[model samples]
Target: MKNSTLGPPDSEAHELQRNLSNRHIQLIAIGGAIGTGLFMGSGKTISLAGPSIIFVYMIIGFMLFFVMRAMGELLLSNLKYKSFIDFSADLLGPWAGFFTGWTYWFCWIVTGIADVIAISAYSQFWFPDIPQWLPALSCVGLLLSLNLLTVKMFGELEFWFAMIKIVAICALVCTGLYMVVAAYQSPAGDVASLANLWNDGGMFPHGAMGFFAGFQIAIFAFAGIELVGTTAAETKNPERNLPRAINSIPLRIIVFYVFALIAIMAVTPWRDVVANKSPFVELFVLAGLPAAAGIINFVVLTSAASSANSGVFSTSRMLYGLAVDGDAPGKFKALSSRAVPSNGLIFSCVCLSAGALVIYLVPNMLDAFTLITTVSAILFMCVWSMILLSYLAYRKQREHLHRASKYRMPGGIFMSWACLVFFVAMLALLALEEDTRKALVFVPVWFVILGLAYRSMRQKKSEGVQLSYDAD
Candidate 1:
């Protein structure tokens, strides 16, 4: 029964407080699992995969469950470890920690940028004249102000943000069900039916390539699902709350992702769901809701803002962890009076503002967004791969720990390998698209930068030793 504000007993050396309660953790998990990926990106996915996109979500969720289980077991095995970055560093090596921590930070920055960009685009729905970057920059500032507060405040904010997503999805699911049952007719004159899932093109509407493309887009929706893993140091009762959150992934996927997709497609044919606009918004309009457009618009705006808020929180924590491990600047290690990583939070927000410049520089915001998302997805895949690798190392080097642990990854080593292979397959799938292919090409540039930075730090340390010897 330790006081959460005091943090874990072994965490006195750390500045972050364990102020997140079970309710906060649970809602954070739900919110993290749901993102604008569903609201904004689903249109493109539906256009590509057709109704089969439903299965894409389910399959990805199934595979990622094992990944989450691996993460959970690793976190529980060592209470001192903050997140996957710490475990990866501990189990694998310092290089693994550096790479995972910074890469994860980059993942969120890219995602945050995308979310901001999306916010600006969504804003144009009502205020068409306002520069897109204005809203994007404004959103970042707002999130930065909120995140500067105590960790409990962050939890509260995320709790409500996630609740909004849950309510929106529930509304869509419930409304779609009623429509299907009542055979609701749309403005397009199409009758609502579950059979719309298959009748159009037998699942592969555009062909194998189209179905394959779904994997590329759908994977992004599950990006923030691992946000729960990052809460290891911040969550109270990790043993109980962490398991509750991680175990609920399947249910969340089924209800929020799978059922929502099914509901949308049932109300509107997959082919008819435009790729350029949100299917959720489109569905409400077709359902004859008088204020459908405004309602969905508000939901989507908040959804993007929620994702951006998460990005700021995650990037700051990752930066804090990196600074503590000497992977990043020492200043990021400093926490505010409230125990929040104030410096890291500000740094991430500053980087996030670059998205506005991107919008200004790149005439086609859509292309910029696609590239940013692809990059984020690639970086996240690498982080996920590292987590799996760390698990394998743990089993080999710390087998006794596994035996003593209460929570264990199901399917064991075999599933871990399978998940790795699946990730590789996803990278290949991502490469199929022209835009995403560019992301794969650019990923190595980051590793090159890290390699040089590591070498320079090593050289500096060597010089310092020489100086000490001369003085002696």
Candidate 2:
């Protein structure tokens, strides 16, 4: 890890515009918390964990709540800090900032690739003949164009995207409740009742290993939940809105994740759910609303778009931050008059265009999605772990700031350690499956590459300095 003596960016010169209002921040946070994972991947999770998948979601959401709280406190502690990456670089070291900033950028890049692949898969529902890479490539181009307009446009895009997701979940929960109350029976002969949760092999049909299988996909589902922390720079009122957004995680998790899973399982037995299809669509079908299934498909298609949109915004911002710290090319540090990172946005989109190549080569879409998402989850874990580690450092070095800060992390340092332990357990679970283990083996290679890049960049900076001395 190379330590940087460079000071923070000039506060007024490089500051991102605060264009995201309260409604945008709220919806962005909601959009971040709920993603394609719930809309598309829940079927696989339900099949693997049986009805116990509900507990899987709850536990994951619970652990991440503390992570957000730590992030909230850190972002609120200093107005100069743009995001977690900003504060981590300041407290932990320059190396921590360089690694975390770039690692987070790569995390979203991997996630964006997964989202585009998902978009292609979902588009096949409407147009089967279109090549998977076509929709994938088109999505990147479209989002890149929208992102370049202004920061507020990005907020509006997420706003409507999140609205579609929230409406779809609400519709499912309402329809499921109606079916259970009316004693509706599905074509598969399962009764719509609360008993479906435990009666089907007592919620742990596949036993301990089955329960563990849920972690690999479930972790990916929660990958974008930390998007709130990234918007601290663009938020109109960080002191009020940031805390409000972070504290609402429990409610959103319960409503969007926990309740949605329970409702779907109750309407359609866990055994009847197919791992390869969207459970949301299957639930509407089970309820005899076949026409509504198409609408559900459309909602999920946009859900993938939403997640990918977020990936573009996050990756560009991370690159901008990295550039400001001298870790990346200074061209990326130049923001447009609109205060959007135009160069950074284009660079990320160009890299994201490779999602098309991955889709073209992989042959099997499911295998491609699995490999990409698993690798993304691993990289995100590294970013999350860095946030927790930064929190520990903040406690040790900035105790006075912690005491004086209005938004302090609850459970203090103990919860931070516990979250770290929980992440290790999730990694162990990911290692259990062959496909996921392959991704696990490949994750460290990214860090090694990053290390080499950092060393080379450091050497170049040193050479430049020595030449200046010789000339003098």
Candidate 3:
């Protein structure tokens, strides 16, 4: 396979290596599918939407699956393209690449900050006396050291992290199923049964508005679903592995998200779930298993670390790509002996430390988390929308390529438009909540900054070209 075009021109020494194997790719995709948002944020989602939160996850997963398929087709169409940023630039314009690349980088950075805050909060579960920022900064330091070692190291870390999450979810589902069969009764005198889903107040107990409110946080839970697209440059056999990973998204969502959520609501009933606490932990505690609650807390702690690790890996690679494309500083183009972008990694970690500052400022963890995640969700939607837009552009300009391709996006241009509309609807949903609406107002400032930066970049390039012309 050709080296990724995002790599430095004319230098094999600087190219990102294709070292991630099939297992790594599969696990990474799985890790991305299950994010910290599900473990930590689902309680709020349940409280807001009642049992209808299940439908929220399903709808988001369904729409995002199409986004992944579109991305997979585009990345596979040109072997040299590394990530969505590359193709967006090619199929759309330089502005699209700049905006997508930086926005995506910013998306992860914002997400990493959220993860840091989550780690701090989870650490408090085990060590209540420890200062919050202590664990947050320590988590960032550990991930940076491990990531600096090799790309495979990152894969191995994610692989194990995902395994923990999978095992926890599986155990939760099994436990819930057992409870349902035995007609297990919780301490609150509520019986665990499938009927619990609607027996109390019906599925849409919160009505349409509550159902709509669920979208705000549920959308955040799926933030990293497109992450596999970022690993395109490093994945082995992109033609084989990429398609396998993308195709399995539906099943993963059903098993991990839908089934796991069903288990939570069935065990405790939606009405009794704590809005500010983890439903996974609460489910275990409701079943009178305090030990399992503690273990689930540890599981969530690792889940937060997993997400931060992913954010670190992706952000660095994105900066490297932007640098190679002349949209970022030249130093970020440098790679370590391991072919990892050390400069980008360090820079991202530094940005991640800002999470500690946020914690100090907001004081209220839930409010801070809600605001940060909403911002992340909004930026991630922008990146996802760009992928759809790029797909639409590809179908229009490269009809021959589409016809010749083996893995064409299902529903093609039509689904692309549909997904775009869904994202717009999600933005409207974000406006319904006070915290999320505050986030919506903050997001425009970021775009305005990017707009000004892009214009400055263009003017400099034009001036340089003019200088060369005058000398000639």
Candidate 4:
């Protein structure tokens, strides 16, 4: 068996530096837990499922926490493995790595496009006449330049971006609590109170079907939750920092996702939440804050920037891993002097720039955003399932390692199967909605393309081997 501690043959020449400290990892994990979906997508979730959206976020978070644990344990099991792709390749097969790596790359590209579109829309809040492509392309260019610097620069960018999100959510929760305490009434004459959660139509106001519908959008909110796993190669002290970051996911979700939604619902009631608007903005606006729109717009704008930044960072890293394993083009494996994968970053940013075109090409922005996000969510679930499957393989093949590991997954194989089942169920739920169902149907085409590419890649490799033998 290949040594788990060993990297690629040329790792000495080009390796990702371990520059991300515990603080960077922690903030990155926090940023991943609190995604742009919460800021921009929760309004629709609330409208569809009412207060039950809170439970949807919680359930998704709960399941994903186990996925993170599985990932953390597997990553810690083999320090040489940069991301889930490495382990999936090692434990499952080359094809597993190929599919997971490229799918994850595509997943973030799709998501980054959504964020790009969102950033443009948010920019329009301030500059109503500005072309959507202007802000969209500008964002891609800015992130590319920043990411091209160093891994630490990416860390700092995410750190500050995450800090902004943290502050916004905390402020929203605190302000909403104060409003509830003082019996603050909105302009619509709705009293802010905890009872507001169920007072209008009860906690599961939309019934079981509405609650089920929430999972589709709510799952997208956690798209980047496992983003910390991608930082294993760059993070300092994997054993300590990786576990620390993973363990805190549950708390972060409760505070950032559940509490923030609760505050929004309490402030405006779910029924009053404008489906197309941000409930975060609606909460403050309904509370009579004159600058609420601009404030939340800036926050959500930064929130989208943060998600796009993460997408850029993770996609490059995954590409670096895939290239090292010979799944992607070898060019992506070359790291800059600062150990940043410049080639992969450029490729990802260029793909993200396509979002600018999406704005012009797709006449209906809402439908486009929905399709993009749903596809992203589906692809993310596939990646998450791959991680769990990798964990299961680790437990079986590396039973001794599992027995000796200091950080074992909470429920071990049992939880792994449970998480897999949960993801399968979520996929079924996707079929119930027309928008998500369309994305669901569209996703199989990606797999089909990957299948063809993998076959061609293998055929070329076999022919190259045969040619070398003939020369010998």
Q: Judged by lDDT, which candidate is best?
A: 3
Collision count for each candidate, in order: 0, 0, 0, 0
Model 2, 321-421: lDDT tens digits are: 88888899988878888889999999999998888988889978889989999999899888999999999999999899999999999998999999999
Q: Any runs in candidate 2 off by more than 4 Å, and if so which?
A: 1-14
**Model 1 — which ten-residue stretch has the worst lDDT?**
1-10
Runs with alpha carbons beyond 4 Å of true place in candidate 1 = 1-14, 465-472
RMSD of 1: 3.2
lDDT of 1 by residue, 352-384 (tens): 999998898876867887888888888888998
Candidate 3 versus the native: TM-score?
0.98
Better of 2 and 3 by lDDT: 3
Candidate 3 regions off by >4 Å? Answer: 1-8
Q: Give each model a TM-score.
A: 0.96, 0.97, 0.98, 0.98
Q: What would the TM-score be for candidate 2 when compared with the true structure? A: 0.97
Worst 10 residues of 3 by lDDT: 1-10
Full-model lDDT, candidate 4 = 0.89
Residue-pair clash count for candidate 2 = 0
Residues 1-472, model 4: lDDT tens digits: 2322266637466678899999999999999988888887898899999999988988999999999999988999888888898899889988999999999999999999999989988899989898889999988999999999999999999999999999999999998999999999876688989999988879998799999999877888899989999999888989999999999988999899899988988888788888888888877776678999999999999999999999999999988888877778889988898888999999999999999988898857677788889999999999999999999999889999999899988999999999999999999999999988999888999999999999999898789889999999
- Model 2 residue 120 CA deviation in Å: 0.4
Ranking by lDDT: 3, 4, 2, 1
RMSD of 2: 1.9
